[model samples]
Target: MPMPAQEIEELIRAGIPDAQVEITDLAGDGDHYSARVVAESFRGLPRVRQHQLVYEALGGRMGGALHALQLTTACPTEE
Candidate 1:
């Protein structure tokens, strides 16, 4: 089954309790998503690493139940 946006947000929040997560369903299908994740913990990480953190939060669900995710990550200060 395709992953729901709420589930995605939940998983991310579970991983980063202080994170602000926003998930949008792209293509009107649950299989594709766009997520904006902002966290204080991301302050020192590079962009690639930031994305990795969000992916890790999904517990390996990407490409399986989650399919594709276009993710954008930033520190809280980045706005």
Candidate 2:
């Protein structure tokens, strides 16, 4: 089964409590998604590590239940 956007958002939020997550259905088919996550926890992490954290949040569903996800991450900019 394809993972729902809400589930994806919930997983990310669970992994990073302080994250601001936005999930978009790129292909309109529910299997492909784009997620933009912003969090203070990502502040010092490299982009690759940041993506890894999000992947961990998915709990090994990347190629199974969750087919494809285009993920982007960033730390909150200081005002």
After superposition on all C-alphas, the RMSD of every candidate to the true structure, in Å, is 1.5, 0.5
Q: Model 1: residues >4 Å from true position, as ranges?
A: none
What stretches of model 2 exceed 4 Å from their correct place? Answer: none
**What is the alpha-carbon lDDT for the whole of candidate 2?**
0.95
Worst 10 residues of 2 by lDDT: 57-66
Local distance difference test values of all predictions, in order: 0.92, 0.95
lDDT of 2 by residue, 1-79 (tens): 8889999999999998999999999999999999999999998889999999999998998999899999999999999
lDDT per residue for candidate 1 within 1-79, as digits (tens), equals 9888999999999998999999999988899999999999999889999998888999999889999999999887642
Q: Top lDDT: which candidate number?
A: 2
Model 1 Cα shift for residue 7 (angstroms): 0.3
Scored by lDDT, model 1 comes in at 0.92
Q: What is the TM-score of each candidate against the true structure?
A: 0.94, 0.97
